[model samples]
Target: MKNTTIALLGATGKAGRYILKHLINRGYTVKALLRKPDGLDFRHPKLVIVPGDVRDAETVSDWTAGCTAVVSALGQTPGEPLVSALAARHVINAMQQHNIKRYIFLSGLTVDVQGDHKSEANQAKSNWMRQHYPDVVNDKQQAYQLLSQSTLEWTMIRLPWIEQTEQRRNLAINLHDCPGDVISTADLAAFIAQELSSATYVHKAPFVASI
Candidate 1:
């Protein structure tokens, strides 16, 4: 919108790809960090791809420098070592060093906030993730703690199961209960992009879904 450059982590992932595309299409400059730069096919004048590991603090710091804001669509893969917690620390450190404030992190409905009052369905979903992906759950929990305690203007967007559809539709958003059960990946990206410049959810976590 304002020729602003935002640093994006996990730009190669399913949701991250959509976020990247949406940001670029909206005329925002994106500096994306990819573990494998060669795997990305899209090229744009406003896109700057950085090849590095998110787990590497120095690498993340270097890539995040000089950006107006940072957004993460990171998620843990099955059996892979958890990087979310470590990456959060590095990203927060870098943002502080560079005086970049706005941070929007994409999370699942499984992660809970202090005053959250989830419905039975959402509770069941959280239990399932905790049982099946314990490490990821733990890592994400720690990341939440770091974010909640940070001075940075941060918003953690908690989403339900993500479907790989390009359709953008009405999304129910709530500060306590999860609004719905599922949402399209495209719509999720749209919400993140729309919130990039808004303070409605600053320093808060909100759950969103298709109603």
Candidate 2:
């Protein structure tokens, strides 16, 4: 882990901040790419906050130049397609240009198209989203498709509804299904940190959380 330099995109977000704290505490040098570096409160000796949008290919490539891996907690708000698509494309190109193979992205559970191993609750949730927020789901699915087809060694963590809870890090992982469990942001950060240290699910997306 000492030799690995991580370039974390969306470092100002809720989950990104947690990952930043974990990386800093573990003595890993992280280059955090955010929309505004000045707005962030966390300052660490090992943390380098780079001000930029994830949609900018040049900026993304510059930030990831010497990085061993990349972690993206990037997402879009409801009814926003441009930002999500642009950022996904930029990340893909940036990783390709820099030859940084490892990538871990946070995608929602609703993006899972395959129905294998899906619990009843998960199925219902998917149906609900399909009936209500179809556009948001479609946008996320497109982002996942881009990552899946890329040559980059990427793992898309399809997270369930996240809550800030006080629980142990005892989450179950599924390859193509939801875990039917809620997860805390802290626990998610711990899992991401663990994945960063070890290349367990490279090139494979998995559902994660404590059941």
Candidate 3:
């Protein structure tokens, strides 16, 4: 918290809000960029909300400038044009410019990369995405490509169906398969918060679900 300032995008979305709260409550200084600043309701001394869109390269660069690490909880919009890949490019370029080394990215399990060996059932999920939601899948895949090829240290936490229920369980993570079909937002937030300094999965993509 002392030296680790976080530059967060998608800070207003469902998962992003939880991630933001976790980081803020944990005493991390968070600089969050939102299209609508008022989307955030609470305030903390360490929380700074910046009004901007993630797709704008200059805005993302400026927002990311002084943060020690970047945490992107950005998600795809159903009818909106692709946003993740473009945003990732901007974030990566900014990280290089600012010398920020860590990037913790959250995405759906459908984003396939080279080292993944998901089980049949898990792989089916990605296949379905590609068949029906090609744009979203393609966008996330490009984002992964950007992350993997970038110089900054990165960890992409691929998630299953996200639930908002209070029901809690132990988190199950695997490099080659998804352990379950769903994960609570609470559990996902905790895992991401812990990953910031853990370095356990840096430069790797892991499938996560609640068990």
Candidate 4:
């Protein structure tokens, strides 16, 4: 895995840090994009901090050069420009340029996709998000559209509520429904790292949670 370097988006995000750590600990080199690289808490030989924003297509391409894969844990930020849609475009372009095939994106259950048999509870979660944070909902939904239309081997892992806690394993995975309410950050990290190479859910969106 030392030869496999992954370009990471949203390294400052709650899930991003843990994901980065998990990759580095597993001996996977990572190029993590950060707006404030000086604020990073730790360092490792396998981790390279790339200072930039995902919205910048040029920066995204430059950051992705020579990387084997891409993983994003980007989430919407209040009072900031939309993130997910732009990240999708830029990342896809970068991936194409490098001919990279694997992309694993972190998203939520609020985005409705075709073939999804979301339960009433999940539908309600989407409705509430659209009613309140409509812009974010729109952006993230657009991100999904872009990802689905691409030919790349992509997995959009939808999560429920997230909590910072001890690392857990043996995640419950569902294709038609969200099987649980919450997942720990460590577990999410583990899943992403594993899914990067597993191709277990390629070209599909799966709901993952703690069992």
Candidate 5:
């Protein structure tokens, strides 16, 4: 693909790191949004490290400029205001203004997509999140709703517990159910990078896990 420039959110996180490397290795230019410049290790001619926060509209607008797509691996942390919903709103607005399409968002199983027939184990995990991390779960659910309402082509990838391994295991991709147990960070990044130009899950949410 020509001019494969992408605006990446959460580039400093565990999954985000793998995603940065994967996209770069796939010959795509990446504009990574970061709250701080600390701890980032990737440097390349195709990589543009933008220092900014996702919640700030001005920063997000700057990051999305001249980008063909957006990929988010954003996650909520304790004591921090759940910003994924707000960030999604900002991203969607920018994409509309800039006429950019194709967005890929990373979500967990707790945020159920429509027609989702979650397995017993997934249900238990969702229940646990409701009991413990209600704010985080609620924010993610709101974020997914925002994506669903957008006119842009978007895919929300619901992932299981992500391990920091280099294993590229087989990932079961399903539309309505949790597919497997756990997927490695390497495998998840590979899927995201490949899905950037794919229409398989456009306007849909797919649950992915290791089989």
Candidate 6:
């Protein structure tokens, strides 16, 4: 996927940072969209930092115009609802307007409304997430619903618990079941990078990471 211009939303967070590094190292032109694009000067030759919030439709639309694909690593913290949904809405609108069809979004495994036979631990965790972060999960579910119904070739990677570790190798990729107990951030980043070039999960919401 050399020369593919990827517009990455939330390009400064944990997973976003790893994705940026992998994209740069793999020689892909990156246009990083961030709410606060100050003080982050990776200074990589292949990186183009676009300083704007994803909530701004016009700004995101402009950035999406010339990009081959869009990757959203957007998330919601404890007390932020409007901001998170607004960003996701803007991303969807911009991609729609520009006719950019390939989108990969980072969502949680609990967003699965179907409740397919997941492990008991996963179910318990989902229950906990629903209790504590109900609004955030609901927002993500709304986002997933919108994306799933859209015409764009979108893939929502619903990941398990994410960890920051030095082990940076590709674990087994699965479509339905969780792959392992924990997923390293590096491995997740590598998976996203691989998906940029392949359609292993096109238009399919897959629960990822190692089981």
User: Model 6, which residues run further than 4 Å from truth?
Assistant: 39-41, 113-115
Q: TM-score of the candidate numbered 1?
A: 0.96
Clashes of each: 0, 2, 0, 0, 0, 6
lDDT minimum window of 10 residues, candidate 1? 74-83
lDDT of 2 by residue, 1-211 (tens): 6767899987877677787888778778999987877768889879888888777788888988889889888766555445666677888898888888888889877777454567788878888987887777787788888888889888888888777654566788888687756777888888888887567888777888776
* Off by more than 4 A, model 1: none
lDDT of each: 0.90, 0.80, 0.87, 0.89, 0.89, 0.79
Best by lDDT: 1
Error of 1 at 125 (Å): 1.2
Q: RMSD to native for every prediction?
A: 1.1, 2.0, 1.4, 1.1, 1.0, 1.8
lDDT of 4 by residue, 1-211 (tens): 8699999987877888888888888889999989889878879888898998888999999999999999998888899998889899999999999999999998999987778898998889988999999999999999999999998899999999887765685688998889889978888998898888897899989999987
Candidate achieving higher lDDT, 1 or 5: 1
Residues forming the 10-long window of minimal summed lDDT in candidate 2: 76-85
Off by over 4 Å in 5: none
lDDT score for residue 27 of model 1: 86
Clashing pairs in 2: 171-209, 171-210
Lowest-lDDT window of 10 residues in candidate 6? 77-86
Model 4 residue 107 lDDT? Answer: 91
